[model samples]
Target chain A: MSRELTVVGLSHHTAPVEVRERLAAAAADAEAFLRRLVADCGVDEAVLLSTCNRIEVVTCSKAGHDPRQALTRLMVELSGIGAHDGDGLLFAMQGREAVRHVFRVASSLDSMIVGEPQILGQMKQQFEVSSSLEAAGPVLVRVFHKSFSVAKRVRTETGIASRSVSVAATAVDLASRIFETLDGRVVMLLGAGDTGETAARHFMAANVGQIMVANRTFETAVDLARELSATALPLERFRQYLPLADLVVGSAGGGQLLDAEDVREVLRERRGRPMFFIDLAVPRNFDPAINQLDGAYLYDIDDLAAVVEDNLGERRREAVRAETIVEAEVDQFWQWFEKLQVVPTIVELREYADSIRRGEVEKTLAKMQAISEEDRERIHQMTRAIVNKLLHHPTAVLKGEGSPTEESRLLSAVRRLFRLGDDT
Target chain B: MHTHTLMLFVASACYIGASLCYGASFSRREAPGARLAPWLLALGFGIHTLDIVRDVVSAGVLPVATFAGGFSFFAWLVVGIYLGLQARLSLAVVGALVSPLAFLAVTLDAIVRGDDVAVPQALRSPWLPVHVTLAFLGNAVFALAFAVSAVYLLQENLIKSRHTAGLIRRLPPLEKLDRLSAGFLMWGFPLLTLGIVSGGVWSANSTGHFWTGEPREILAALTWLLYAGLLQLRLLGGLHGRRAARWTIVAFSLLLTSYVAVNLLRLGTRHGLGLAG
Candidate 1:
């Protein structure tokens, strides 16, 4: 039986990063795990794919074997977790869904860094490893090649790739596009947390003139200040440079990075030189009302994620184009698959028809007292056409449903109806 | 004439078949079936060989005396050279490129074919074939350079977008396309110069004036100068890659306008230009 292609997995939509991080299959483990899978679960063929965002196992088997249990067992063994702990987290797909899953993954639809373009390489590497192990047979080979073709076609045919945004970097580009220069821009950090540190490093990378680190603590502020090559300021004194720094990043110890009153005081002090406040906090450190201010543009983590997510959403929108591309590629693979079946059926049908035509033409020619050579040739052509017309529809239908599952029944029907294999 | 027409059919069929096969190859990487490209290309060359030989059948009345015959020959050369390069380098995208070019060249070359407008006595000089053939071949090379540059611009954009589509994975890099375009022009320019020079000599002897007869010849010379400047800039100032590719494309567009479009407009300065017009 030809294994159908299938996919089963969850992305950021179904799981948080912490959960995803735990599920991520390290590179070295995947190969060993692929070997263990065949040994443990009677896996005939298999390829393991693990990206930062997605963990999926594609496999084929023969005879009596449970795949979902087999995959779940492999995950537990590789992850060093309780075997049952992964039951709810691991997704299992059987046939066509498995093939379709890999296609989508190769197309960047299953990426954590959506449209970041590294997953295709990762998939190719995994495919190579599988090929090395002799785990991917002909069907898997067709699936991979067709997936690559679909991804290629999607990129060329659709505008999904045309629009993309890196929100973290977009803030910088947008700021520069607005102000025309980041050379002398004063960037203030509101938090001493990682998100704030990321913003500080970006500003430093862009060569911003100065940075002011303001945190809830005087000491932590000093540490961040020295690291960023900027002066450390107390939280109370944060309003002093509010009018000075053109860009502000919030990454503080407090759950809420910044409040509305904090921004209102700064906006009042700035006299409106245009300030961009980038909020890199989860629950939002600043009140969204700060966005309502006249010259201050305040954006939270969700807004930034929204920008990347919008592109991810755009890619999701384009997944239809990607799916359309995959559909055509799938059909092409199927056509080859189908034509292999059709060729034999066509030859058999033509041979069968030829025998009847030849028999009738011979009998008629023998009986004819005065048939010209031209008349005989004409009669032969008429008999051939009638045979072809009579058999065309049934032969086409027979080949159309020539899957081995359907072919057995159809073959029996053809044999019994035509007595094809019976000797007179 | 019947044989000539049959050979034309065979040539065009080979080109069309070669195009489809290569296109399938790009979309199907693992399929050994797409290996038909080399054979189809060889087939085209075989048929094209027959067509060119047939052209020589009527001796002095060479097939290129008609406009279609000349363009078709040039088309075959472009595709033939493209196939040769592909065989040596394993470049698959050349089919995506060189096939359409061969098609257009053959199609356009055949456009004014049936008319067989007699060559004027003045243009019937011994050097006329050499001059005309060289110019058409040079234009064909420039057309190739333009196609390569177009791919360069697209690959550059794909890089900028940071999207590595499968086609992007399959395509030669922008730098390679740029170099190929420059290489084409590098050789093409000198051939064009010889063509123009031979024509200048022919015209001076027979018609008395070259550029004065066709103001467009001056345009062609200027186009040639632009490419010469580009080649010099490429070597001397390291102005290459897309910049050289751009200049080649620009110069070719002007060459095309001067050679084909201007003639179509019947814009000329010669007293006998009116005779052809």
Candidate 2:
């Protein structure tokens, strides 16, 4: 019998966070759930993937049983939600759709933030858990392994994950556009606002030469500097170090700290080296007119957000290319799976032919008691060869080269023609 | 057609093809033809080099003696230097900017058709090749600087305007472009100074005068002074980025105008190559 793959899950797309949290199982609990699913839920193999954004129960069942109804019931019970509520939240997919779902999830195409890297790791962890519990059979193992490689192909072949999508990341991206490498470049944080601190941390990660924290409150500056391993300076003395900064992020709450004239003086002192100013302040710390300075570039919070939006749009376009890759891979995997489905029908046909051949040979030998033992053995061998030759063409048509649709059709036709029971 | 002309045509076709590929790679989100463009450019440069060598061998002189040969040699040097720098820098967009200029220069060479000009009696000296080569090399370096500075301004405008989109990522950083432009100026200034000095000595030996006060000589001197001033301001006053880029464009425009006016139009008494004759 062919085993069918099925998935019943709720993701951020279908379920609210409150419902997902209730359905989300711990690692040990998920393993026990897989055990129960395989042992008593009419599932031959099962894996439960639970993350903060989603909870999916992937199962392999024999062709005769519909495990979806049983699995959905268990999920509703697990969530402690009403049956009607669970029906709206959980999505059920079987056969090729299930395979595609697994691939898309592993590739992060189905992620809340598309092209994020954490989904594939989370899937692999759950797959390993199921395998160690012996709840994952050959089919689940092959499907999970293929999903990993598909995710890798999607990552390398497409630009889905190449651009930065967050505000802090967008600031780094803009910084790189202005400067060649951040290796020896300096970044100054003016006021130690939360958003500015986040952007500074990103620059630090990019290996900026040094980070300076200057705030109106000197102690606050010192505290942030200690945490970030940077130098702290009083706000009054920040002008002394302004010329050294390649990137200056302003999060100070006060209005218009640096005017156009002040920045022009700084540019002259630095010898016209470019300075990128990210203004994350609410009331605007740097003068907007500073952007007009020849070597000074100013981007406020709204500008940074606009860049992030643009990057997200680019990622959406790349995701279209990634979806095409996933579709092709799914077709390839389904062909292999359909070929596996033909194996059982071929075995059943061979067994039926051999049984008839053995019965005819025995009956004939009983009637030929006057003949020698050598003649009897020769007769049995002759019957066996005739049966094998007659069955070869039928078996080859069922098992040999054809499309998945053609193979499945041939499998059922051969099964019925040979009177092979579907039970096996 | 002669093999020399046929090779030039083929090389020009390769450059055009490379430029289109680079344009496609730059304008699109995906860099599909980025790898193919370098190979196409290298092939064109190789064929152009061979064509120049053939001309030098057959004529028994460096190919800069005629207007056509000088234009072709200038294009060859530009492509050669760009290819060399492209090996080390991630500046593929510069190729898109440069290869079209090369194609245009080659096309200008074909139009002038000055390949059959005989070497003048006064010009038959070892100093002719030396002076022309140094001048052309400096001009080529400045041409590359011109393209780099153009890119720097484009990138700077995009960053300042907050339109960081598809084409900006393909371009090198502004600081790198600024630094490269300055480096080109520093190198080209000396070669140009030497070229002017050698031209003076050659003129004294051939015409019994060191200074001609001709239109071409004056323009060349003016071009040299402009570059010298720009380089001095860059080195000492720390003038870089947008202003430096604008100065480079202005200087190159002057150099290009002088070449077209004095060489192609035959405006000056000396250094015209006598294409009309």
Candidate 3:
């Protein structure tokens, strides 16, 4: 039977945001689930791929059965949720299409963010899990290795990975606009939440003059400030220094602490110099009226979302181009897979034909004891020619048909015609 | 005297070996040249050490109480420090360019000695070693800077003119060569300062001006100021790659010309050949 690969899963495209987030596997959890895939699931070879935006399982089987049902059932059992909840979220691709999906994913040509180097490392982890479980055979080893080379090509040959702009990076760009040089500017980093902490770190790397943290809880803010080697002051003290700061990025853990009147008082002291304000908080902390202040640049979460959306669109266009390259590469992989199926038949045909030629030629030579050395050499050359001439047509036909055709018919024909299997 | 002849022959061979190794390195652009560079450097250094040892042994004392003696002492001191730096930095490729100048200086030393020159008793003082050693080491550092700056200038010109080929690949990156040149300046400037100070101390009691006129002092000061300015620009202006490279070449050229001009003036032509005590 011909073996074919199958990828059966939904991703950010097919599923809703909520569904994708729930189905996605964290790096640590994907390994255990990968083992169960081959052990209890109907998978001969498998790799589990999980990232922030998508979760997919790719498998290969000779049985030609739809592995999706088995995989979704496996997902349901692992998740401990009702199978119906994930039933509508499933997507499937078979044979060559499955290989194309895997190549695209490994190359980061299918990620929500194209040319992001992180996905390559994630796919490598999945491959690592499969290898550790002894689930990846020679076929997957070939596919996984080729994926790295294809990824390297897309990275070097295209400008997709160069000069990338991310959200954190955009913040740095915006900061440069406000300050002539970070050589001597002070910042009031209003929160030390994960995103806020990350933004603070970026500010520090740019060599911001100094940073002051103001959070709802003074202790937590102080702790983060000390960790960053920045100073922390009270919430009430924030207004006193707001106008003194060159930049104010308020990711205030929660709630509006700065009003229109409050910012007006702050702006009054700020002079004519520009002050950059980024509110990453959900319920925008700064008054909407504060944005109208002269020399004040304010951006909220929605503005950042707009920037991310624009970038995502650009990412998709390059991803489409990359996808075309990956599809061609995957076709090459399938051709190699196909040739693998034709191997035993080719071997049996050549070996069986050669043995018959050897047996007859030897018997004829032995029967004539007066056969000269010249006659013996002539017989050897003739026997090789006869074998080649007889086997040439069938070998070409067998190798070309390879795996798309049902393999059993060809195997049986080789056995009966040559009586090959009986001797083995 | 025969040992002296043997010393000159061996030192010349060392220079030849170092030049051959460097030429090989630049041509082949491979490990054999880089590997041979250090060995050839060691061979040159070994012969140089033996030559110096034979000189002292043959003379009963350190050979130059005469102008010939000072020349030989300064020559070995310059080349000796250079060979030490080669061992330290593994810059035998640089030694290729320097070794010939070294051989020439030593040959000049031999010629001056063979002329049966008189020993200026005033020149032979406890201060002589300090003044000569510091001056020689300073020159050695300037020589290193000169070689690196020349390489930097060539690499920059090649890249700017968009002509890259085998030699460019063999050379270290521009930033590395620039830093190496700048590092030489940092080292040489202080040694130069000490040499000037010692020379001043030696000349303090003597009458009208010093043994040399104000021009050597002025030129040395000019070189020091240029290097100091270049180093400051490298640090504060964050100047790097080609801009910093060009400055290094300019500074090193000024430095080298100062030494050459001072030496020529010492040999006394129509040019002032200025004064003597």
* The candidate that achieves the highest DockQ relative to the unseen native structure: 2
Residue A207 of model 2 has an lDDT of 95
Compared with the true structure, all predictions reach lDDT values of 0.66, 0.85, 0.66
* Model 3 chain A: ten consecutive residues of lowest lDDT: A156-165
Q: Which residue pairs does candidate 3 place in steric collision?
A: B64-B69
TM-score of chain A of each: 0.56, 0.83, 0.60
Give residue A167's lDDT in candidate 3 (0 to 100): 61
True interface contacts reproduced by each model, as a fraction? 0.00, 0.82, 0.00
Each candidate: chain B TM-score: 0.87, 0.94, 0.77
Tell me how each candidate scores on DockQ against the true complex. Answer: 0.01, 0.67, 0.01
Winner by lDDT: 2
Give a tens-digit lDDT track for model 1, residues B101-216. Answer: 67665656544466344556765678776777777677777777877877766655543333433455566755467667778878788887887887687677776765564566
Which prediction has more favorable DockQ, 1 or 2?
2
TM-score result, candidate 3: 0.47
Which CAPRI level is candidate 2?
Answer: medium
TM-score of chain A of 1: 0.56
Instruction: Show the colliding residue pairs in model 2.
Output: none
